[model samples]
Target: MAGLITILIDGITYASWLFIVALGLTLVFGVLKILNIAHGSFYALGAYAAASFVGWAASMKWAPGLSLVAMLLAAVAVAALVAPLTERGLLRFFYGRDEVLLVLVTYAMFLIMEDVTKLVWGANPYYVSEPYSLFGNVDVGKQSYVGYDFALVGLAAVVGSAVWWGLNRTRIGKIVTVVIHSSEIAASMGINVSRVYMGAFAVGIFLAAIGGAFTAPMISVQPGVSVGVIIVSFAVVIIGGLGSIEGAAVGALIVGLARSIAVHTAPVAELFSIYIVMAIVLMFRPEGLFQRIQARKI
Candidate 1:
């Protein structure tokens, strides 16, 4: 029973951060119709930025609790600075181009950002371990867990609820939804689709960055961190159905539990467990567990 509880807690904790990242990926795909191979790069930037920001905060002798604020600011800064440059300066030009072309473009951007991160932060790993103990520890029955992990679970819940409420209950969200359905029609209605596109992209990048920010303390902030995240995030969105908020959530839980189980039971299968589950899901539901099959428009 204790072992089962540990697995469940570990799975939920892992799913929390993943859901945050995958939510952004799905949002970008839903609104902009771009798969955004560079999304993981933004996540890396967030971690690097968080490491810098939190370090600065510590140097200033700020309360350790405020490191959380620094991490959040890091995410906001990345979104504010990078989103415009990527969306307007580069991706906008490729609008209406072939989807394959867009994918290649984003892949190129990913490669470029990989080099850029090394150039700025260098190849050395950065650590933000200070924030990891902010929440101290929580005892769960016979097992003990980091309080920070439970905090992440709460944060994920808040993020998901906020995004859902914004999209379903707000005027701008309705406009964005219309644009998602038919950007041309929305533009004809004087909705300013370009601005909507930029807004959605910024929000998506913010989600990715925030995921990285919080996760910085949990792992080494270094080059190649984005690679693993990108692979798993893609798996999540694919399993949940691209562009689906609910799908992202469910997919993350499934992946997280699968990985946790593998790690606890069969360490050798840890790497393949996620992919195996993804393959099985794809076999049974190619459109994903949540995505409906839409009739092709003439």
Candidate 2:
């Protein structure tokens, strides 16, 4: 029973983090119809930014409780500063280009940002673990867990619900949905489709940034961190189905639990467990679990 509880907690905690990042990836694909390879760069950038901010706060002897706020602000700053610059300055020009070309462009951007991070932050791993323990701990049976981990689970739930509501219940969401269904039609109907695209992309950036920011305290913030995240995020979204928020959520849980089970049972399979599941799922449902087959206009 204790073992099962541990697995449940570990799986949920890990899934929360995956969902946060995967949500952004799926959102960008859903609205922009572009597979942004640079999304992971945004995640790395957010981690670096948060590390800098929270480190500065620590150096200034600010209240430790406020480190969480600093992390949030760091994410907001990245979203505000980098999102528009990337979307409008770079991606906008490639909008009508071949989708393959756009993917390559973002991949190039990701490579560039990797070096940019090293140039600005140096190659040293930044340790911002002080805030990780601020929330105290939770004791379950003979095991102990971090309160922050549970907090992440709650955060994921809130974020998932909020995104679902924003996309389904809000007016702007309706506009975005219309644009998603057909951008040309939305533009013909007097909607500023470009603006909608920009907004959705920016929101996606914000989510990616927050995922990194929150994760910074739990791990070393350093260069090359973005690669692994992007790889796994692709797995999650692919398993859950691209462009589906519900798919992202479900996919994250699936990956997280599968990984946890592998780690506890057969450590040798930990790395490949996610991919194995992905392969199995794809063999059955190539469009993913939540994606519908769109009738392409011939």
Candidate 3:
């Protein structure tokens, strides 16, 4: 019973951060129709930014709890500064091009960003462990867990609810939805489709950055971190159905649980467990669990 409880907690905690990252990836795909291969680079930027921000905060002798605010600010800064340059300066030119070409373009951007990160942060690893203990510890039956983990679960719920409400209940969200369905029609209707795309891309990058910022304390912030993150994030979005917010959530949960189970039971299978589940899901639903089959247009 204790072991089961531990697994559940571990799975939920892992799923929380993953859902945040995957949500951004799906949102970008849904609105912009661009599968951004550079999304993970933005995440790495956030982590590196967070390390700097939190370090600065500590040097200033700010309250320890404010490190959270510093982390949040790091994400916002990355989105605000980087999103426009990427979307308007580069991506906008490639609009309406072949999807394969877009993929290649983003892949090139990913490689460029990877090199840029190394140049800026160098080869050394950065650790932001100060924020990890802010919430202290919570005892769950026979096991004690970090309170920060529960906080992430709560944060994920809030982020998900906020995004859902914004999209379903707001005027701008309605306009964005129309753009998603048919950008040409939306533009004909006088909506600023370009602005909508920019906004969606910014929000998506923000989600990825925030995920990395908050997760920095949990692991070493270093080069090559983005590779694993992008891979797993792609798995989550693919399993949940690309562009579906709910799919990202469900997919994260499935991947989290599968990994947790593998880690606890057969440690040797930890790496393959996620891919195995993804392959099985793809076998039954090539379009993903949440995506519906669309009729082919000649």
| Cα TM-score per model | 0.99, 0.98, 0.99
Better-scoring candidate (TM-score), 1 or 2: 1
**lDDT computed for candidate 3:** 0.95
Instruction: List, residue by residue over 1-298, the lDDT tens digit for candidate 2.
Output: 9999988888889999889999999999999889999989999999999999998898899899999999999999999999889999999898868999999999999999999999999999998887889879999999999999999899899999999999999999999999998999999999999999899999999999999999998888888899999999999999999999999999999999988999999989987999999999999999999998888876
* lDDT values, one for every candidate: 0.96, 0.93, 0.95
Candidate achieving the largest lDDT: 1
Clashes by residue pair, model 2: none
lDDT of 1 by residue, 151-264 (tens): 999999999999999999999999999999999999999999999999999999999999999999999999999999999999999999998999999999999999999999
Which segments of model 3 are wrong by more than 4 Å? none
Ranking by lDDT: 1, 3, 2
Our model 3 lands, by Cα RMSD against the true structure, at: 0.7
Model 1 global lDDT (CA atoms, 0 to 1): 0.96
Residue 221 miss distance in model 3 (angstroms)? 0.2
Give the per-residue lDDT digits (tens) of candidate 3, residues 1-298.
9989988999999999999999999999999999999999999999999999999999999999999999999999999999999999999999989899999999999999999999999999999999999999999897999999999999999999999999999998899899998999999999999999999999999999999999999999999999999999999999999999999999999999999999999989987999999999999999999999888857
lDDT of 1 at 30: 97
